[model samples]
Target: MAMSKQQRAAVVAILVAGLLGGAAILFTGKGGGSGEAGHEHGEHAEQGEHVDHDDHDHGHAHDKPAATPASAAAAAAAPAQAADQPHVIKLTPEQVQQAGIGIATAGSAPLRGSVDFPGEIRFNDDRTAHVVPRVAGVAQAVPANLGEQVARGQVLAVIASTALAEQRSELLAAQRREALARATYAREKTLWQEKISAEQDYQQARTALEEAQIAVQNARQKLVAIGAAESAGKDGKDGKGGSLNQFALRAPFDGIIVEKHLSLGEAVKEDASVFTISDLSSVWAEFVVSARDLDQVRVGETVRIRSTASESQAEGKVSYVGALLGEQTRTAKARVTLANPGMAWRPGLFVTVSVLGAATQVPVTVAADAVQQVDGSSAVFVAVPGGFAVQPVKTGRSGGKLVEITEGLQAGARYAAANSFILKSELGKASAGHEH
Candidate 1:
């Protein structure tokens, strides 16, 4: 290239200007690089993490809505105060009365007396009787109907027996002989006293009288053995007539006829039961007790018997109690005699028998309703000034409506007698608030 003096100066000036511009660009790039590297080094030192500026700004924009300082502080304090709020219940005094809630003071009180037992009504064995045929005979007629009440010696049925007929015949013959013997003895005595007959003749007549008397006695015995009664004459005197076979049976006791086995014209054995009579004036309450209850029962102890079938309640004394438990049920039998005055207690009716024995007094007791169950443990709601609080309780033997409080609750503390559920709910609400 050809250069003039002016061209060389201009070209040289253009080259110097280009060199200054390049140095300025190099310095600006170095300063920018240094700034980025410094930021990376600081982030790594502070957080032990490599920093990417583009990603940092992207995440910062996404989290901006959730970073309110006021909301964070409020959320942190919400749970702390929730547990302190009291649970409120709106209930009037009348509602409490209707719900049966009140304080029951713990003190000595008699436990309710209740005993659950199972028994069946039965007739008094000693007062019952079975009608049996005294001799083999045919049942002529049964006058007594089922459940018909009869008195002792009342005719219940009729029976025909050949043996009875024969016995009556013998009794009639003997009566005639006795009359003849009495007449002969009277004549013999008169003759001897008057000296109008030979002494030997009078003696023979007396001997004949003695023989006739013996025969009469034997005949009377024979008649009695065959259920034959000597007939009374029309004038209510002795009429020694031969009697026919009996056509009626008599009741042996005062009772209601419960069963009749024979029918009209039916042949019956000498010992066959013709009628079953039950005296309902007194009944038996029989109870079966377990072996463990033996000590609680005694022969003279009083017992209460109740039947759901009737309104009659009876008190009875233990008449008998089996000493040994049954081999099958491991239970002993106990019997009580109850006076079924109106025969309200029927045989086979179910009855609840409660045998009362000696009472053991407990030192302290509380109403059963005051106790509640919490988490498998018994608890009581103790009435405080503001509300009811739960008090864990330990209970011993229970009697009726009262239970022995051994622990957790004191003897003098007042507790919610009833409607404890409402109090429990109030306490739960307070606890929830306190937990907050």
Candidate 2:
């Protein structure tokens, strides 16, 4: 179908006019000469509006968002919403792994509430002793050194005492007298039976023998009371008087010699505490509790103890709780007995004691590391369709490892358990970009 010349001419003119109009619109939009400034101002105004819109969107996203398709679409459409919405984060599985992020499922956990108190590790007083020589003496041989471990009845030092020598001499003399009196009494009895000795003679001899026996017993008891009888040998004799003045200071129990005050040839008093021995297998963690906290701490309650110097922890039982408060501090003394395996919990080490209270059953709980601070609120990075989402949470009681989520999260929700801080860092970067 061929057209006439006039019809073709009219079609060409209409095409030329449409092309020119489109070029004019494009030039005006690109800020052509006269309209350039107005165009730039309009762009700046649009950017300001975008910033304002984002700020408003972020405010609502941090609170609770309804679980609906519209909200989901809104969350997906806005990349900046990842920083604004508490329920959205933009990360692929590969990116999440590259960031060293870990996931944990929220679930029910037994929440053991606890109270903490500052404490100090100390020697168990029951197993600690200050060794003293009952008799004043000169230290002859100092065998035990400081920090040396000794068993019960082990000799710590040997002392030479004039007083001990005299006591032993008296015992020896009494024994000899008792033997002689026994022989004389027997001879007198025989003579009287034969009518060769008088009855009075036999009675005097018997009385003398009884007195001698009493003297011997008295001397023996004196030595026993002074801790000298054990070192006196089997026959109750001190090496036939050669070691009459020698007194051995022995350990009262299995312990380590923590203090040594006496040296060889040093003179010591009878009541002087020359050595301090303590058992390090177990130690006491002593703390003070206020009057209001007295009821919370009780004997036989299990407590968690942590060392201040290191990442060391142990479980202990409350051994003692004072009935009276301190006169000056107005606080009651409490103690926990902890087993010091390998003697790691040394005395004088500072510790924190956590007294566990009743257990609670929480419906939703996550690892403590999963909860991170986002926008100044407690939040968790929850896994969503394409990436992880920031879920604002209301937290309740928390143990060291797990924390209870009171709201804003549900059971079976996967979250970043370890290295969640990485996500926080990334979120901060994204927010900073938008801010600029």
Error of 1 at 12 (Å): 38
Candidate 1 TM-score to native: 0.59
Residue 366 alpha-carbon offset, candidate 2, angstroms: 2.2
- What overall lDDT goes with each candidate model? 0.75, 0.88
The whole-model C-alpha lDDT of candidate 2 against the native structure comes to 0.88
* Residue 417 CA displacement from its true place in model 2, Å: 3.8
Q: Over the stretch 235-269, how does candidate 1's per-residue lDDT look in tens digits?
A: 11122332277635678788899988988789998
Residue lDDT tens for model 2, 1-436: 9999999999999999999999999887776655778888889897988877876978766466557998878877787654455345688889988988888899998999899999999999988999999999999888899999999988888888888888888999999999999999999999999999999999999999999999999988988887885334422223344377888888999999999999999999999999999999989999999999998999999899989999888998999999999999999999998888799999999999999988988899999888998868999988888878788999988776899999999999998899988888877777677767
Error of 2 at 68 (Å): 32
In candidate 1, stretches whose alpha carbon ends up further than 4 angstroms from where it belongs are 1-107, 110-118, 198-228, 232-243, 288-295, 306-313, 322-333, 350-352, 363-436
